[model samples]
Target chain A: MPMTTTPAEPVTPAGPTVPGEPAAVAEPRRRRRAAAGWVLLPAVAVLLVFFFYPLATIVWSSFTEPTVGLANYTALFTDGVSVTVLLRTLRTALIVALVALVVAYPYAYAMTRVSRRTRAVLTVLVLLPFWTSVMARNFAWYLLEQRDGLIDRFFSLFGIDGVVLLGSVTGVTVAMVQVMLPFMVLPLYSNLSSIDLRLMDAATSLGASRPKAFARVYLPLSLPGVVSGFSLVFIVTLGFFVTPALLGTPQQSLVSQVIETRVGDLLDFPGAGAMGSVLLAVTLVVLFAVSRIAKPTAALNQAVDRA
Target chain B: MPSTRAGRPRSIGWGLRLWVTAVAVLLLAPTLVVIPMSFGAGQTFAFPPKEWSLRWYEEFFSSPQWMSSVVTSAQAALLTGVLATVIGVAAAIGLDRGRFPGRELLRSAMMAPMIVPGIVVAVAIYGTFLRWHLNGTLLGFVLAHTVLAVPFVITSVSTSLAGYDSTVEVAAASLGASGWTVLRRITLPLLMPGIASGFVFAFVTSLDEVVIALFLQTPEIRTLPVQMYDSITLEIDPTIAAASSLIVVVTTVALLLPQLVRRRRSES
Candidate 1:
């Protein structure tokens, strides 16, 4: 609006009032776009080579590395322990996602009610552990859960023993939930902040209790966050190797450790590749299922359409 | 929330205050332990540490081995920070400022590296590099970490650019400026905070990374985390405490730059 109008006219040039001049004017725009493509082609090429190729390479390696033809993937299903671990991994992922929501939603809601400075500080604290090395976090948890660790001392002070939270599946699950809580929290906080407080007030004025107001007015409104958080934590939790490796006993091994053992300890490249392929297959199927649930673009449309 | 206003949680509720204080202290438990451990007078990794001394800190400064790993990690982090930030800033601008095909796909791909398990990527890259004979080298670590760190740069810089208006660039261009000139003169200043945030994030990620360092580590070139891993897993010692404290200090500074900016922004 504030522009000197002459410059705008030259770019768009009430063009083609003179037909030959239209092509002259359009030519540079086309070339500029074409030039952009040329500039972008190298980046796209890098992605294809680095990102796309490795994904395909692992898939192919699974099949062809050892005497060819589905041996690796087939071996995973055929091996009972592998199948069990995959199932356990999925189970753990779901539980983590569930626990993250349970823990994060209340905190996020509380965050929204707090003053900006308080929220900022809290958000920083929530993000603090994340900023540190995951290894460091895991080690800290290890220390806390150890026999002589702080938590153990506290429990022992209360005269409790035989408490094995660190090396158990439960310990790993709790750690995983802690690890993924921020993923669940941030999206919810975004959606929650966007909500006008009046909706809850309106619900309350109409005789709804706090829980009722949250359920009827807030929950449906925040479905996008729930979906996003669930998918994110679930997908990430599916790929986790570190927490399990650090916290879980041998029996609690995840698919990642299996693959690592195969490749690193076993030197069975084909088997490792095959296991990777199987995990990839499951991930794709699970991802598709999640995308269906997330309906991300559709959710945006729904939000837009709501307005 | 306001129902509890007069006699409850926010006002005269000492119980609530106590709970909040307790929770905050509980949250800080792990971080606080680092200090006591750092000051351990004993050679063991014990809490309450038997006594209090700065011997480990002295050892950290005196030991060339620990210092070299710190130097290597810093170099790698700096290189990764710059590389990731440049590529990330370019990609962020390209995505936000330019309309292009497959933009969403390109973005998802760019951000995907961060989501991929560090071990998986490390192992995959190790496998790839083995065939190309790219292992056991600093360049390999740099390239691998640059890839790992790019997603953070992209996410942060993208969010920063979200607050940006592209019409300014268009206006600049229409005012007879070239694209590069418009970007240099109009865009860079606004994006500086975001780029710096991304830079810090990249540095932190590079510094803290261990899984990738593990598979890529050779005697010739290894980072702090790798050394920590080797030290702890092989021979437990007090030196590790000093190293951890030092990284924590550096990391706290790096991580807080964006926070300071945020606080300043909020204050203004």
Candidate 2:
């Protein structure tokens, strides 16, 4: 509801006017609202019939398909593969969120302090990946992560050997962290820029050390943004498919890969549906929980709109 | 905030500055590496190719499969962009101009495609399209992608509408212009930048999307990304580098086109 980033929508001022205009204005207003309703019908109807209906069918099949009980959901737990992949997926998502937060916080903080031109450049850098093709970026990561590639060479210089990033969870995580950083930075920047830095200044002036002042004041205030950023990154990484599939081996598969296999190779629609349903549930729950503390919608809008 | 006496800028120390620079490099370098790799003369996925040529680009341009996929992708993206812009512009106008019950609810519904995970939508749409026999069709690609692309259009148009002055429409109406004419002559012109941006974003969104495209792809009707994906996973061909660079360049220009348009509009 706190669409803080967007300016308020202006009310239309083209309502009907007549010489005797009191009661007649009400009828025209009703007609205008109806006209607006008509304008809205096409897009809304298309999404509902195409998008939501399909989504619901898949979720429904998770329950009703293959004998109409909780079998599919129960199988997800009892089946060793789904549970392991689910746990690995959760663990990977958490690591990506934490790592992105560490990198993004200071970068976002710097964005606030820099001169306007510098800020513009930094903003462009942050957004560059967002605009770049996803497959292209992933391809570049593949080139770097492949055997004896740049990453291996970098590690070799430090006397570390056989450090192949490809076909491993590490490769996927490294690529994913880059993918998720913008999501983290934009929200954190939005939150950080709004914080009254004077609080830190006030604390330092009161004889508190600068570090302690920041710890007690700035860090706490930035938590909402941190929470928002973490959840957003976490939720996205949960259902990530392309990166893990491209960089990772089947032996170290994430939940997304498992879901893909179930639907694509195995043709186990019910099973895949169940897994997809759980992924959707987790995403929504995390978003809902974050919404309570921070304006996830506002954070998401800032991240997406980059305004 | 700087404490009036010490009116220098906020003291972002060297450590933070260094970290930010490193982060910026980390964000940008990987994507840029593809450009050079794209022009590599070698067959293997080698960096700093011992020799250099546009061999891969030549291959990409010559291969019928790649060419056909390119055609499919271009057609889908163009269709998705146009269809989404129209529906989204209408929805933005509806949301902006109308005061109705559940208006906020409807607005949130428009954004749902963005919130839902890509793979989920891909599978769901894949499954549903299968039942409708819509899979492997341009209409399928367009409809699925339009769902994804519409949200971008809606957001862009809504942002533009937020800053728009509705009084111009009122002025036109008071001068006895018809509702449709006022909208056509005044409202649409004022919102052109937003509308243009919305179209570009939608175009780019459809152009770059791969998850849903992958699900809906058939051997006969696949897109460039599906080809690029196959080249990566199914084969070790380096020609994907050329395709990747081309895509990155195209999408970057498409995304920036709006910014340039807006800047030019403001200057004019």
Candidate 3:
């Protein structure tokens, strides 16, 4: 196996004695290599037993339950409520990604232009919300969107009266955009900062207008960041549970809500498992597609590294 | 137009800064709003409170149900921190020091939990835990949360290990120090900051986690987030605002503490 070969080749010459001593030294080095591999066992075992095992069980049940053979999958496709929720979930994710991108772009751009002290403050503003509990942030939104609450009262002052945001798609979208904005900003900022400002200077020196220089020289360069940020926000919004559940009503229910309902209220385990499987599959597919276009992991690591 | 070229971008920069400031305000609004709301004397959540008091905070402290959930969350988070850091540090060392085929794959698999949607993992665990009868147990909560928390620990520890010079271990070994001795005396002490930060990250992750906790919660066992969720969805009590504010303060402090320490260390 490649596993045995890769470590053995390097360790052979580095064995306990001179390079000429082959058989005796090779044995202990091999044993050490094997022992090093065994260090991975606890983590691997934990993941297998607790993480992958449960996930596999869910996939298994989705196939086998209710006298199996694709029944659940078929039902998921044919069921009107399920299909609508699935589509709505996708649409919501797309909207949240786009909205967050639009809102985050100028801020992330401005971050690149700011002094180091100002940029540090801006980064904290971005990350504070990111680190706060999802439930806390959602609860704050829930209160704000309620009738005669902060949002409604603020709107009423402008003569925009009787507009209820709670339980509406607007409220859910606003909350999600707020929650996902940091995800968009961090990656975009990392990518933007890495770009050499000299490129813009060069374009300007070539007699390109500032806007033209930005569009032609800068935007395309930051495309990888945009792609990475969009996919990150979209995938996270796809499975968003807390904000929507707290703020949205049945009319605006997303797929996670449906999964929660199926499992939590209805006690339909296999059905929920099928929905989860679909969500997981779609998430992985989107990640795979995004990876083809941009290195999401590199963007993520850069952002985290900056933080 | 020479002056225009120089002045135009500065003008745009000012406008962008204004826009960015507005966005920052919008981002901070929820956290800032909740703190004042937590002090509202009214029974229900209302803005610009006519009365301000600490009744809700007192309520949160006095209520056994709320207090118990706090205890439960702390216990689970603490256990998860210890368990995840130990396992994650071992995995990181193995991956960093040991070169073999499938090492990349193993590392990716370790990180899969972070990418997979939380609800899917929650549902999967909920289903399997139902069979294992681990649904409401503390061990169940720790194990499931550790699965989620380990990835962060690994990421943090791995970053630290990347800067670490492994030849130090080779030198120690050559000087007659054993493997365990080298790890104990040399490697771990050098990696202490990363491991500590990883522990805090794991703790915060488990503390903030709600999806798996939601699935695992029973009447007898509920974490703070799950309880807060129930309060928001099922009741209109403003005590949750108090609870939420507390979490915001505590988590911000916890998250920033390591950075502060690191900065001070660098300065020194």
Q: Clash totals for all models, in order? A: 0, 0, 0
Off by over 4 Å in 2: A1-30, A206-208, A303-307, B1-7, B251-268
Give the better candidate number (1 or 2) by DockQ.
2
The candidate scoring highest on DockQ is 3
Per-residue lDDT of B1-268 in model 1, one digit per residue for the tens? 4542321212324544454444444444565566567788987766667798999999888888778888888888888888777767766656653456677877777766755544456567767766766676777767778777776776676777778885576566666776456557887887887787778778877888887777777877788888776666567766777776765666566557767996799889
Q: Is candidate 2 or candidate 3 better by TM-score?
A: 3
lDDT of each: 0.66, 0.83, 0.83
Give a tens-digit lDDT track for model 2, residues A1-307.
1111223222543344445644433333334444665677779988998899999999999999899999999998897788888889999999999999999999998888888658867877887787787888899999998888888989999999888889999999999999888889999998988887777768778867777877898899999999988988888898888999999989999988888888889778888889898889888888778777875545755455645
Q: Reference contacts recovered by each candidate, as fractions? A: 0.07, 0.59, 0.53
Alpha-carbon TM-score of each model against the true structure: 0.85, 0.90, 0.91
Please provide, for model 3 over A24-103, each residue's C-alpha lDDT reduced to its tens digit, 9 standing for 90 to 100. 44443444455567677788999999999999988888899987688998998888788888988899999999999999
Q: Cα deviation in Å at residue A116, candidate 1?
A: 1.7
Candidate 3 local Cα displacement, residue A36, angstroms: 2.8
lDDT of 1: 0.66
lDDT of 3 at A193: 86
| lDDT tens readout by residue for model 3, B126-239 | 988988999999999999999998887888888888899966765676676755676789889999877887897799889999988999999999999999999877887889
What DockQ does model 3 achieve? 0.50
User: Which pairs of residues collide in model 1?
Assistant: none
Which sections of candidate 1 miss by over 4 Å? Answer: A1-32, A39-42, A292-307, B1-27, B97-100, B253-268
